[model samples]
Target: MDPINKEGTPKTPTVIFDADKGKVEIRGRSIPENSIEFYKPLVDWLDRYADEAKGNTEVNIQLEYFNTSSSKCILDVFKKLEAVHKKEGREVVINWYYEEDDEDMLEAGEDYQSILKIPFKMIEIQE
Candidate 1:
């Protein structure tokens, strides 16, 4: 399947969903006006990828900020990956990166980790 790549704008995030590389990354801010529209394709792609997933899949999420709607969309993305990990029996790893000083981001990662069954690594980087 073709990969999904979108450049980040001030209101959105940069998305790189490369199935061939078994890597999916979402970086930058995610405060799109319509989060559902912005993330639908990503969710769809993950659904398709679940059917023919290869080795371990690594998901890197580094968001400086995101709105409430975007948060739900992000959860949808995680849920899709969870399906792959649970129902499909694929190894899915989530690396949630945040700046050392960003307590909100750290807590956000922890919250998601608590809600999802997938393994998540909270990576702290120097700001």
Candidate 2:
């Protein structure tokens, strides 16, 4: 399937979902006017990718900030990935990147980890 690549803007994040490489990366800020609309295509793509996913899938999420609405959409994305792991039996790992001193971001990752069945690796990067 074709990949989903979107450039980041002041209010949106960059999204790169490559099925061939079994990798997905989301970075930057996400505060779009319509969070659901912004993430719908991604959810649809994951639905398709779930059936034909690789043995291993890696997701890197490095968002500096996201609003409440985006947070739910992000969780939806994670739920889709979780299905690939739980139902399809594929190995899925999510690398949640946060600044070294961004406790809130780290906590957000921890919250997601607690909610999802997929494995999550908390990665702290330099600010």
- What is the C-alpha local distance difference test score of each model? 0.93, 0.94
**After superposition, which runs of candidate 2 have C-alpha atoms over 4 Å from their true positions?**
87-89
lDDT of candidate model 2 versus the reference: 0.94
RMSD of each: 1.0, 1.0
Off by over 4 Å in 1: 87-89
Q: In candidate 1, which residue pairs clash?
A: none
Q: How many backbone clashes does candidate 1 have?
A: 0
For residue 67, model 1's alpha carbon misses the true position, in angstroms, by 0.6
- Best by the lDDT measure: 2
Candidate 1 local lDDT, 93-118, one digit each (tens): 99999998999999999999999999
By summed lDDT, the worst window of 10 consecutive residues in model 2 runs over 82-91
TM-score of each: 0.96, 0.97
